[model samples]
Target: MHKPRILVVDDEPQIHRFLGPALNAAGYEPVRADSGREALAEIARKPPEAVVLDLGLPDLDGQEVLKRARDFYEGPVVILSARDREIEKIEALDAGADDYVEKPFRVGELLARLRVVMRRQQRQQEEPPPVVHAGDLVIDLPRRLVTRAGEALRLSPKEYDLLAKLAEADGKVLTHKELLVSIWGPAHAHDMQYLRVFIGQLRQKIEADPAAPKLILTQPGIGYRFMADEALRPSGA
Candidate 1:
């Protein structure tokens, strides 16, 4: 069987020098691209199972590369960069990165992250159970429909995506960055206003009282949580 291919886009030779052997040992076939332009070209030439992208590229910036790659690529793209700032990580994630790893990352940790990404991707591809009921609203995942008290509720594409993401988490808190990246893609990760507007729109339709939402609860500075009912929550009350 062909080893899973990982496109490593970085300008640094040392990264390639070490990553090649390390990835090889980890059962991945590593391909190198020194610049964003080259990375794009390489991706087009041979589609990779996943991408390990660096933010600062000689020819094109990493975020741009990620956006462009997303136009045609559907696989995971993990941002491997030195930029450790929260905003930078948010930007990269919103730009289409599946995961972010700081430059001084441990090989074991990186490998484990890749595994997680792959597993999540696989799970997303697999179909889940048909419906979810949280409070008074019912969501049909396969049909992409939502209803409240037997009346169908209309929702925008983004709103549905956001709600579905939260519902799947089963009462877990999802960070602002995590929700934004997962729903709107990485580019809008920092656009809290967008989230606020959409979340409000969603509440108007799903919540019995938008003024005092019970399904979607704010976690103050951290993020938001889907207040699933005891029966709906994975813990099964």
Candidate 2:
């Protein structure tokens, strides 16, 4: 069995020393990159299952590395940085980092986070289930039908499309720009108003109480995520 590869990008020798053994013990093949340039090169050469990146690098900012990597790399990136400010966290997350961990962190916590992201990635790669169940709602992907409490709910074309997109994400946060670009095309990439309006309409139709939605949770300044518990069936089931 081949262990999943993990790329560690940090300039500190001590970090490499610390994480190398921990990752190996956790069943991951740890690959090291001491600089942003090397990190990018390694990623292009062969992308890892996930990347543990540090924001403070000798040549390039870790955030910049994340932005550039997002151009082509779709793997999970967890920022292991010393920057603990709320703004820094938001910036890194919005820049495409999956999760953030401040420095002086526990190895156990990092391993848990890695497991969550890798599992999420695996789910995303699998063929979407034919039907998804969330609370009292049921989404029939093959029929594009949605029902609440066994009653069919009418949704506009765009609204259904948006809902389908969120459901297909498998609980991942879909950034506002990502949603816009994917749903409305590049010309509407900056149309935040359109997204808000549609989201509101979707909630009204789907949520038992649209005012305080539970199914579609907002990520505030980042994007939206589907938080309702989902029951997914196997592809061939």
Candidate 3:
């Protein structure tokens, strides 16, 4: 099997120095880009399976690079930056970032996120069964519909796509990359913010209590898992 390729876009040499070896050790081939323009150029030349994008670029804003990348590349994008504000994180996620990490992060966490993303991607390519059920929420793949408690729930295209991906995985955790690619196409494989917004929407429509969700569950820094409704029910009742 071919090792997954990851494009690391950062202006700092130190980032490349530290991340290259880390990614290599994690069984990923790392490609480097020092600026937003270079990153775009490299993507145009040949796209990778995933990208680690820095928000602070010398030539252009990292968000702009992310948007442009989504225009063509279909894969997961993990945003790496020094910005630690909650609003910034939310903004990036909404813009289509699959995941976000502040600077000075642990290599172990990064690798874990990578694995989650890739696993989901592999599952999607396999094209498993269309209809998926998680708890009370039932996803009708062909109709792009979701229902809970026997009532049809209206969902945006992106929201429906997100549910379908998670439901397909049953209870397995899906990384940000996997969800982004499955819904927004390959070009948006890195936009995590998009996932956040759609997830919020999905919960609102499906979860009995959106604030304290029992279904669409978050896995901290990793990703998300759609709890099987069957598992939530009492056995042999």
Q: List the residue pairs that clash in candidate 2.
A: none
lDDT of 3 by residue, 1-237 (tens): 687889999989988899999998888899999999999999999888888888889999998999898899877788886644545455566576766666678777677666655655666678755667766777888878778877998777667777877776645556777677777889998788888989998888888889987788885555777766432211111
Q: How many clashes in candidate 3? A: 21
Error of 1 at 67 (Å): 0.8
Candidate 3 error regions (>4 Å): 128-237
Could you tally the backbone clashes for each prediction? 5, 0, 21
Model 1 off-target regions past 4 Å? 129-237
Best by lDDT: 2
Model 1's number of clashes is: 5
User: For residues 106-142, could you state the per-residue lDDT of candidate 2 as single tens digits?
Assistant: 7887887688678778877887577777889988989
lDDT agreement of model 2 with the native = 0.83
Native-structure RMSD, model 2: 5.7
With a 3 Å backbone cut-off (N, CA, C), the pairs that clash in candidate 1 are 93-186, 94-186, 94-187, 95-186, 95-187
TM-score ranking, best first = 2, 1, 3
Q: After superposition, how far is residue 6 of candidate 3 from its true place, in Å?
A: 0.6
Give the Å shift of residue 147 in candidate 3.
Answer: 13
